[model samples]
Target: MAKRIAASLVHAIETLFVIAAVALAVALLLPRLFGYTPYAVLSGSMEPELPVGSMVYVHETDPTALQPGDVVTFYRSDGAVVTHQVYEVDAEARTIGTQGIANKDADGSLVHDAQATPFSGVIGIAAFCIPYLGYAEAFCTTPSGLLAIIAVLALLAVASLLLGKSGSRRAGRRARGCGNDG
Candidate 1:
């Protein structure tokens, strides 16, 4: 019985380690291969399209090929970054305009010429989005998130230690109580 339990525990730990390694590899490789960045929508600015706390997978594109109604992520004149749907793209004029579906008006004036870069300048696009998953990702990036994970791991470790200790003690008692003449 002890041997069976030990084997099961070892298998479980090994399976968990393999899963963690695979997840880490995928997270690292995805951005390089796809040329897209993953961003979590943090506000209602683009609501009715991308809700708050949604995960967006973005792809870089060419500036000349940008069409109206395409959602874009860009840097503003003040160095602020925003993601909004393109209202207009004037290639000849080298200007782009964007509006939030939930906004009362277009975000002031059009994004000025020269300020707008090529689609290549866009770090990513909304490729794959999931609602609410961003919250977990965001939480995990913080110190508290790390602490929470550590706490859970510690709890599991303590439980495992106690179980192993009790099992060994029970086995020892059984061996001592058994009377055999050899």
Candidate 2:
């Protein structure tokens, strides 16, 4: 009974792991087919809405189409990519004012050069996000992580084969014992 229970538990765990891995792969790959780019959130600026380690999908859009309340990813003068909510748009000047949801002030002020982010700096508007999956994507891209995945798959295959062999052996032994008792 204990052996049966252990086998069931292991099978359940394997099933769950496979489902999770497939889901993650779909989430990361499906968007790319539709021209959406994934960017990992590295800060708490967009917290609650976009937590750290989340993967945000950005879709490139026309600058003139952007409006207040739209969330967008843009390049900063310093070369950093920032994702923020548009609080204002100046179509004439081709600039957009943005602010992080968690911040109390806009991204800039008159004292800070009095300039809104330029339309040319806009990369794309955020489409959707998957929390904590960015970390998985980042890790899976590394050499060590890929090797670890391969090792795990090999181990799982070996374990399944061993379990099958042991189960068949036990069945054969039970059949022999019953025949002897007859």
lDDT over C-alpha atoms for residue 111 of model 2: 21
**Which number leads on lDDT?**
2
Worst 10-residue lDDT window for candidate 1 reads 110-119
C-alpha lDDT (0 to 100) for residue 3 of candidate 2: 62
> Cα RMSD for candidate 1?
6.0
- Scored by TM-score, the top model is 2
Number of colliding residue pairs in model 1: 9
**TM-score: model 1 vs. ground truth:** 0.67
Which regions of candidate 2 are displaced past 4 Å? 33-35, 77-80, 87-97, 104-120, 142-148, 172-182
